[model samples]
Target: MSPLVLGPLVRCVEATSAAVWVETAAAARVEVRAGDATGEAATFAVHGHHYALVVVDGLPIGAATAYEVLVDGVPVWPEPGSPFPPPVLTTIDETEPLRLAFGSCRTSVPHDAAGNGSHGVDALRAYAMRMADLVPAEADPDGGAPRWPDLLLFLGDQVYADETTAEMRSFITARRDIDEPPWDELRDYEEYAELYRLAWSDPAIRWLLSTLPTAMIFDDHDIRDDWNTSLTWRRAMEATSWWHDRIVAGLASYWVHQHLGNLTATERALDPLWRRVLDHEGPEELDLSEAIDAFADRADQDPTSYRWSFVRDFGNQARLVVVDSRAARVLEPGRRSIIDDEEMAWLDEQVRGGFDHLLLGTSLPFLLASGLHHLEAFNEALAAGAWGDRAARFGERLRQGVDLEHWAAFQAGFAEVSRMVVETASGRRGPAPATVTFLSGDVHHSYVSEAQHSRARRRAGAPPLQSRIVQAVCSPIRNPLPRPVRFATAFLSYGVAGVLGRGVALLARAPRPILRWSYVRGPWYDNNLATLEVHDRDLRMWWARGVVDGDDHARPRLEQVADFSLDAPERSQRRRKRRAANRSGEAPSAFARRRSISST
Candidate 1:
């Protein structure tokens, strides 16, 4: 295949410049046009399934406007049947704060398939089909529908190479039998490329990505389950020759489909792969499709070689540290770190500078539910050889990349980040910590946890790195977890957690560690959407899911599952006391990102 010119991906937009990622299935001369015959055109070529990053410079600093994509002078998307024309380039208005809707683990479930009749609205598709609508012209200021997002951040699971949809399965099953070891999933670059199409090609989703400026990161499902954990896991897989091609295709295609979309201007200017794409000027000479396959193979087999994570700071008020926890892992013994030193150092620096709020976008959350946390902890200890016999073998299997989960398994790295979150929020390193909120997913559930910082862990009157920290999770957009598993997880989290599992493993010379579940303060479920608002010095979070409303396809609102507030108790308490004393309702507008009076 050639470069998939499937997109004019509206990528990063800062104050004055916005980045648009253009790709073709094959090499093609590409030019982007904005505005009337002001005739300013920036031209580049698309590499095979590889993107050519074109910075649409000198755009307006703020406000809305629509733009166009010209591939060899042809308007591909919004060519016809597009729900909305792409948004005009606007600087990321951080002072105004951001109201972004985010969630992950979407499957290619039909938007209005009668089988899923209970929930009529496919939240992802609905957002697209509704974003750019045709309103009556008499509305003057062109009063049709509202432009949906200033930005859309997709955290992870945008595609599943491991799991296939019924439609996708038909192709896979017909082309090749999946009864083999790596059956029921994707295994190579070609397959991975198709996965991306099945995922984002939906008319509604493509509509959103075309218009709403987006930032993305990948989790395990983007490739496979428990992608990279330890050296043993890598060795276990290396036993098969097919593993080489599978991983190569996965990482190579992942670079094309997702990671490239996250690169900044300077990064692309210096990018080894894309620099050539931009410089060469023609598609045939830039035949990187085969070479990138090999490069991805090397990166996956040798995790220490290349880095996949990145960081972005939205002015000084907010900073984003995107952890590439899966790709750059140091899985070797005594050298275990979810992210190698270089990536961690970069993340540390970004978080060091103070911000009103810090958003850590790791595909996996640092904090796990009490139940899940304990289970992982027990597994960690077992894997680390606290127990004897097969306990160690079992633990090894779990950690040696059994499941690509949170940091806990990589204890040293987990401890380092946990301390970072605590210290950053406590005001020890920077300001007396503002709000350190970790935004994450991939655990197949949605949740919010508040981290209470304490100075007790330290001596003296040291400002406790103890402050309120919040962790929120949203996963598997269309794939709901089983009810039985939810209950089992609850029992394991609360009941089997702590050290009893460690004791059993030990007394039988196979002691399992204790992983208590008391820390979990919320409910868990499969398939939901989580949206949050961090304003007014208070943090509020809510989770919702799709639901059929009054037998209407034309209208649907988010149905709320839970709402919780993580306010600076010190501030909220003060506000309460002052309000009572003064009889006032002074909620700050900065924090007034509100929900409807009756949350649907």
Candidate 2:
């Protein structure tokens, strides 16, 4: 086997510099050579795994350059006779339009016929193949052309620690007792390392990561489902004999595998742990296994001590703020919030308006369908003792049993962030952008919803909204919901759930939400990936899926599922019609004909 284990992933790319990460067979000096620019770093050890993130600087702005990776002076990348084109590093240039692909909840499975028959096609893999022009011209009417994106944002759930696949289970069973607690689930850094390798090691995906700049954040399944959902949930998990080690290992691996590369050169410089790695000078490789474990433990215990949220800018064109909605949560009773006080304060500083567009990437949707939003809010009230102590106990059970934990479930956090977004849209914070959009995934479906402040707020003198405030959700890039469950989810999220939620809130005396939103497209349940492109002041987004031809599951073709343009005149007309229909009490089914693209 080659010494290069998993990456040479291009990360945190900027006009002047870029970070390239790699995992090696053993500790060694890793070097990235691009044209005349070269960057090298010594491998650091974490639980026997060797890794390095070499920051290459002095690259020309807006340029793409082919790069090669070498370990201990031996070229290891661009594997002998590789079919795909050589990997290239592309830097950001503000004048150019910014495009990015995003989605969440992918399961690692074989990319052949059996896997496609079970979990549907792997949209990310299909996209990677399409980008490389590997799909036959006959498969795509557009000639299988490539439109290279500026970045690839993995919203969350890069790996499902709790939901192990057959391959992952085999790895687990070979090393430990399968009947033990947390059975079939990951337990330590080694397991997580394996899980990541399985997820990213596919030839097409590996090549995609090697060339495109990527950023990621974690959601529940990265550790376990409903992670940090509530104080009671946290307590129950903490009481487990194995939970401590599981959490420590999960988080430690996340820092090294996902979070470290999300930071830019300047941001990494400010990180004390990264500073320790960068400033180390010795013949021996620096080992951080113990230190990383301690840090992850402390971070889990007190989220305020560390921040997982990060910001990236595309010159003055746009700002992408990826929030740590899971780990940074405050689960304390009465003070429960999606994000703690410190994180909220930090978000307040980051959510301001200035660029042509503002993008908020959260693992969970900030705005669900109006009905689902109210339902979650109602559940939150019941769990907080809105009725009685007994009811609160029952509510806690219901909240966990069903996943009633989203932005709406934490009213305080929701309201505060809503206010911040409102301020930004109304130009109280900065020059209002053309759109203030929340890009999220976790719902296992895709949709677009537009929001407006409540009439009460407008009556109380909130400025007329200048920016289009919208929520675009694209989920399950590979994992599609079961057929039966999709019907129920659509009914609840789009149908009577709104009225049911409002009535329950009235009974609980829960305060009404300050914003109203309606779905503009989707509830489509395809396993797909979505991309957004910013052209001057307008933004266009579309979802696409992989379609297998005949028996050729290994070579699925990319097919468009849905497309929407935020500032399109037709969309504006549809929004007006939707509002009129809502006021007239028309059923959501009546608006189905208005969707821009038909579901596949």
Candidate 3:
């Protein structure tokens, strides 16, 4: 058997089971051993490539268990005499608060000085180093300090099929004729497999993957820039011969590699594709090439067929609903939406309250800068024929050219999700969550925004506000926007765009946004990773980036950019209730001091 090519990656973990994904140069039976619990699964073939998802079961809930990987009964991971720490599988605990790390947009390149200088430092790698340093040099009975997060959420753009680094370009050139229409971008399954290997093979990132239980969703760049952005773009792509194969390969590989590992055991058992593979009685690695490709084709052609979006209940403590903002879109001209009605119904079902916090992970921000939000809405209106025929044509060109394909661009879809959010926040769906926060990426910058509810929602006889709605965005774990492009984005998102967007909205007769918002944290354009912690009636978030000291680009240091904390809505309500109950003229400061002492 050939050696492991990509991972012993711990993908999705629950209270009792974990999915460890791996890829090898050839077909092999892979096993994951944790304590005495062992699970083995044979590698399946896709386009001549081999991969397996080893589901390790019967794990102790809420605790970390170290695991080792074996390829055909021979140890292959934590490779013999390796210096790095052993891989660990940590299951979720119902009783404990959740701490999650999330970000998106990364490019795979060398970690040397040249790579750093060209592409900026890698924030994820820097985070891995920090996690490693948390362990003590000497062994202790209690084992090294445990500061790992409960889970990690990758918002989108985990891999860039449309963009290529120098190394990627070289590989593509060596393998095929670069003069082809697609040029430096990826072509098919083999190229995508190579891209993933490059993206996940770095020692630090690999270690991070092997330990951190992760869930991911793909954005446009995962397949191509502005994928499924508009009807115009889709028509153009379909006109090309190679585009169909590229999309099929992209979605098929995504299912085999990323999506397959995300499902719970029960969910996997229910999957039609997996059910067929698992039921096979033969003692050979299953080949899912045709089935997976057909499924991908059907999924792309009909967004309602297979739901890419899913919801996870973290033991009733928190709820994570990751929405598919790209592929499951309704891009029918004049009725464009980020998600179709079926998807919207599913999302509505998931957005109900009752958990401490409700996290909506969308690749596109639900609430962009008020200015950008209005601009996208205005563009959508024009593209929908608000303007004259010639002007509408111009609007379509502008929307496709500038990549106006976010929630804001889909007025109906945005309003629907916003209404759901308002309903949940007002406790109409269920017991209101402390916060309804949207975690997002794909704009190439990081920021946090708080929603300002519409006047109508705050009118007389409205349900009392019980949950705070906010948007938190983190992007580009490694890739950086070029200086010129960064300036253009900033101006369009925050500056001149706002002033002109309003006028355009009036001209287009665009409806007023249901909820307006403003940035409270940042619009930082750095390669960074973000972490969110839910504890002590507060939700705190921090962003960090990798920085190189003078002349030491290879050994990048992780530096904190900014951190902000939001008061949990339930906490504020409690304070109000206390004030109402205490009729006496007790000073606010006195109550605060008393509450602080009691909390301690």
Candidate 4:
């Protein structure tokens, strides 16, 4: 029997259940064994590729158990002669604090000096190595429970279908003519399957997947660059004959490999395709290739027919709302929205505050730099014919060119969501959360910012904005922006871009935004992985990067870049008193960033 092609990846874990996804070399019955509890699922084929998701149930809440995968009564994972530590599944518990790891935009290539020099060292791989050689007692000096992430939220670009690695290019060159339309990039479902195989086959990353429960949402490069940015862009893509096949294959393979793994057992039960496949009663493996392919095609044509977004509540600890910002966009000429009416309505309903924290996960940051936000909103006005037909055309081109299709560019949607956030924070929607945080990626840089409601509203005896609204972004888990490009981005987003953008806005008679914010932690450009620890009275965040020590690319050390402790209302006052008492000391830059929040 050939080896397992890809997974044993733990996905969508609940208190008592966990979902494990795996891809096989051929059709087989896969079994996940944890102690005496076992869940068996037969592999389903999609265009000749086989995959399965086994729902492992009856797991004790917050218990750690060694798990193994068996294919056809033969052990396939945790290889007999494997050198790394054994993989284990740690079930989640609602009573404990939630710690989540999040990042986006990783490109899989070799981990040698050449690859590290070009794309930067892989943060995820380094983290995996750290997890493997961990000394549990040392990790927690007090001898209490150690800090292990409950889940990993992959914001986007898990696989770059549009950008091919050297290995992928070699495979493409061998099979097909490279001088053709797609060139080195992927062309069909077979190519995409191979791309995913290359991405996940790395030993360290594979081990990380086996142990960690991951939740993923796609961004542009998952399909193509600037996908569905505007009506014209969509039209241009639809004009290409190859685009149809590319999109169908991308969504189909994604459904089988990525999106299907994100759903819970309950959500999977409601899935129409899953329902049809489950209706099959047989001892043999079920082949749903045609059905999956048809569903992908239909979803591509009518995005509203299938909803990609979902909500997960952690027993009043927190609520996570992961939205599909790309496909669910309303990209008509006259009216454009980041999410369609149906999606927006669903989002509005979920944004109500009931949990301790409300996490809005979009691949794009909702709260960008104030300067950049103004520029994008200004561009939207010009594109909406505020100036005239000629300027509108120019605005449309500029919008797609600079990649300004974020929440700011869709003013109506941005305003609507902003209002919803205000309502939630002000206790109008429901009992207010301690913090409303927007966790996002896709700018290739990471930062944390806090929104400041105007003091004028408070002066007028209006209810003070009690809840903290924060934006925490982590991006480019491996890919780093070029130095020159980084300089340009910083200058344009913070300096000349703001003044000129606002001047254009005034010329076009655009209205001002409802809120303003400033950076609290960073505008750091390292390829990083970030972790968020949600406490009862504070949210602590940290970013770590891979440092390849002395001639060893295989074992890169994880180093912290920056960290912040954002306090809740009562804790903020206590922290302020402590800071004031120690005001004479010269604090670090990260701590200085925190001190500035008081002025806001």
Where does model 3 exceed 4 Å of error? 136-146, 459-461, 492-499, 573-586, 595-600
Model 4 lDDT tens row, 1-600: 555889889988888888899999998889999876789988887888888889888988887778899988888888787767677777889899898889999999899999999999999998888777764222321112375688899999999988888899998999999899888778899999998888888988998899888999999999999888888888998998689888988998888878988898889999998887678788767888788878888988888889999888877878999999999888885668899999999999999877888899999999887778878888888888888999889998998888988888888788789889988888998888888999999999999988866454555565666678999999889999999978866775564677786687677766665666778877899999988888875787888889998889999988888887777865676567657756867453565467667547
Candidate 2: where is the Cα deviation over 4 Å? 134-146, 568-600
The numbered model that scores best in lDDT is 2
Error of 4 at 334 (Å): 3.0
- Candidate 2, residues 1-600, lDDT tens digits: the string is 899999989989998789999999999999999998999999999999999999999998888888899999999998889878788888887788888889999999999888998899999988887777732212222121245778899999889999999999999999999899878999888999999999999999998899889999999999999998899999999999889999999999999889999998889989878988989998999999988999999999999989999999888889999999998888877888999999999999999878889999999999997777888888899999988999999999999998989999988899999999988988898898889999999989999999988878878887788888999999999888999878877877775778887888778877777788889998899999998988788788989999999998877888899988877334466668776877899864545555523523
Global lDDT of each candidate: 0.62, 0.88, 0.83, 0.84
Q: Compute the lDDT of residue 511 as modeled in candidate 1.
A: 22
- List runs of model 4 lying over 4 Å from the truth: 135-145, 454-462, 493-499, 573-600
Off by over 4 Å in 1: 1-5, 36-51, 81-88, 114-121, 130-147, 173-181, 281-285, 397-404, 454-462, 465-467, 492-521, 524-526, 550-557, 568-570, 573-600
In the range 245-281, model 3's lDDT, one tens digit per residue, is 8899899988877888778888889899988778866
In model 2, which residue pairs have backbone atoms overlapping below 3 Å? 371-498
TM-score between model 2 and native: 0.93
- Residue pairs whose backbone atoms clash in candidate 3: none
User: Distance (Å) between predicted and true CA of 249, model 3?
Assistant: 0.6
Which has the greatest TM-score? 3
Tell me the lDDT of model 4 at 278.
Answer: 77
TM-score of 1: 0.83
